[model samples]
Target: MPLVRSAHERGITTLTLDSPANRNALSAGLVGELTDALTRCGEDDSVRAVVLTHTGNTFSAGADLRNPPPPEALVALLRRIVTLDRPVVARITGHVRAGGLGLLGACDIAAASRDASFAFSEVRIGVAPAVISLTVLPRTDPRAVARYYLTGERFDAYEAARIGLLTVCGADVDAALAPVLDGLRRSSAQGLAETKRLLTAKVLEAFDRDATDLSALSARLFSSAQAREGMTAFLERRDPAWVL
Candidate 1:
């Protein structure tokens, strides 16, 4: 089944991650599907804003290393969300880790369930969170990011909101996000697009002049010895035995 699912109505579209068994992992095919969906949404004038959510307990558990995606493919999908003309909001519930956190950052607004937790756990497996670095690094507080990235520790949704990772928090995340959607509905699509463009331009400028180097770095991380070991261990249901 395609990982990306959708329900469109009244000029607002909700795109859902649907691979519940795998916690909606970012497989290569899934990345392609997401990219395609986002492109279609952008081209559709009726879609004024997008609300991203997921099926089951996890919003997303991040990438499935057992079936890894191409670095460039995943990166492009995230870039699309970041640069999309319409407003994007993440409706986060349950656990969101690693690449999942990247999706939250890419969106213009995020609302999390009161019980949800956010984490950056790539380091626990011996590799850096390269694919998510550009998005998460800027949006999250430096100290909070440092603690999580360095230790692979988890933080609750309220902390996520406190650090600017989420715009609202409530037991009913959908209810919390409804006002944001209403605000989007009241605004002009062109105005929203221009605002998003201006914000993203600032984030884009943070990278060095040779920003392609970051892409290269992500590719390298995917192919690294540590990543290989970590992915193998995960599939085997064992602790990764990597020498630091």
Candidate 2:
């Protein structure tokens, strides 16, 4: 029940993640509810654009390890974001880590507050970003993925936008997002769908052949003794022994 509220009005549909205590981590139910809401928005012609945001200080901390979604849910989550016809905007503030990074990358437009920071933290958690990596890395420059993935460093909003992971970064995030949504409202839904499809096709074409390579890397990363030691150290609030 990590997803707390879903509402639509005046051509904008907003879905909010409710697990603020855990920094709005993604739970199984959250994924299902979010997927369902996004699907509903896609089918409803009245919906002009989708806004994915959260209610707490942190936009999303990432997928909850205690309640991980199944592989099917993970696949559906990626496909829903990838195939959605309307423009989707991710509104980020505070700390967005791990799978939250994925959600940002999956959206058509991402606007973050100046205070917002993001990270790909799966490496430290002893797991691959997996489904998240699929959408997240493609939206960003491929070369930086290895550095961020291996280092698990937290990056600020400006750096995110500079690297192409985020589209917009500013203090007035909601204000910045307003005009973008208005522009989307002016476009024909069919045209948006076609554009999304063509663009997605082109992006996928580049990475399709390397799917196995990424997966192998993730598997090895997750299984490494260093991953386990690092994750344990993080959870225990101690310096990782694996660090130089």
Candidate 3:
């Protein structure tokens, strides 16, 4: 079965992260499938926009700890979203953590339900949110990024929106997304594509400038002794040795 599922309605294509047994974690398989889906959407002129969503209580539980994609692959997937011709929007009603926030940041717009939560969880895992910073740092408020990135503290959907990690949040995410989708459906394909290009230029610039270093940083950290202990403790459902 596909890790990512694609569906189309009117001018919008929806790509759902469907690996619910893992809370839609971005494993190599899932990343490759999603990248291919977006490529197809970009090639189809009928696709005016794309809605990136998921099928579980967690939008993404960060990278798949047991089967994480290569950091370079994650960087490429993020760049693909930013550079895709059609506008990419995130419709989230679940928790997002670690690299999952990068996916949210890459979207041209993101809407979440009040029940949704977010965290920069890499720190707790003895790694930095390095590769993800390409999309995240450019879009979110610096101070907010500092606080969450350093502390690995969870924040609500409202706080996410306030910090620019999300475009909007409401009691009903679908209802909040209705107008946004309607706007996309009404937009000319060329108009949306060109507009998205303008909006994402800075993000693309960051990718070009920092992706290599960040990917390397990610690889190095994930292989270190500290990260090993952290991952082990996580899998064991216990606090890591560093936890106070």
Candidate 4:
């Protein structure tokens, strides 16, 4: 079965993260599938926009601890979303953590339900949100990024929106997305693509400038002794030795 599922409505293509069993973790396979799906959307002139969503209570639980994609793959996936010709929007009604927040940041717009929560979970796992910073840091408030990235504490949708991590949040996420989708539907494909290019130029520049160093940083941290212990403790459901 595919980890990512694709569906189309009118001029919009909706790509859903479907690995609920693992909270839609970004395994290599899932990343590849989603990349391919977006490539298809980019090539199809009929596709005016794309909606990225999920199938479980958690939109994504960051990297798949047991089968995480290489940091480069994650970086490529994020860049794909940023540069895809059609506008990419995130429709989230669940929790997002770590690398998942990268997806939210790459999108041209993101809407979430009021109950949705977010966190930068890498710190707890003895890693930095290095690769994701390409999309995240450029879009979110620097002070807010400092707090969440260092503390790994969860924040609600309202806070996410306030800090520029989300475009909107409401009691009903789909209803909140209605006008946004309607606007996309009414837009000329060429106009949407050109405008999106303008909006995402800075993000793409960041990708070009920092992706290599960040991916290397990610690989180094994930292989370190501290990271091993942290990931082990996470998997074993116990506090790591350094935890007080």
Q: lDDT rank, highest first?
A: 4, 3, 1, 2
Quality of model 2 by C-alpha lDDT: 0.77
- Scored against the true structure, residue 44 in model 1 reaches a CA lDDT of 97
Provide the overall lDDT of each model, using Cα atoms, as 2-decimal numbers.
0.83, 0.77, 0.93, 0.93
Predict model 4's lDDT versus the native: 0.93
lDDT per residue (tens digit) for residues 1-244 in model 1: 6789989988899999888998888887778888899999999989999989899999888887777687777678878898789988998778998888888888889998999988887886766777677787788789888888898889998899988789899999888877788888999988999999888886666443323666687678768888788777877888899644
Per-residue lDDT, model 4, residue 45, is 83
Residues forming the 10-long window of minimal summed lDDT in candidate 2 = 202-211
Number of colliding residue pairs in model 1 = 0
lDDT of 4 by residue, 1-244 (tens): 9999999989999999999999999999999999999999999988999999999999999999999999999998999999998999999989999999999999999999999999998889798999999999989999988999999999999999999999999999989999999999998988988998899999999998999999999999999999999999999999888878
What is the Cα-based TM-score of model 2? 0.87
Off by over 4 Å in 4: none
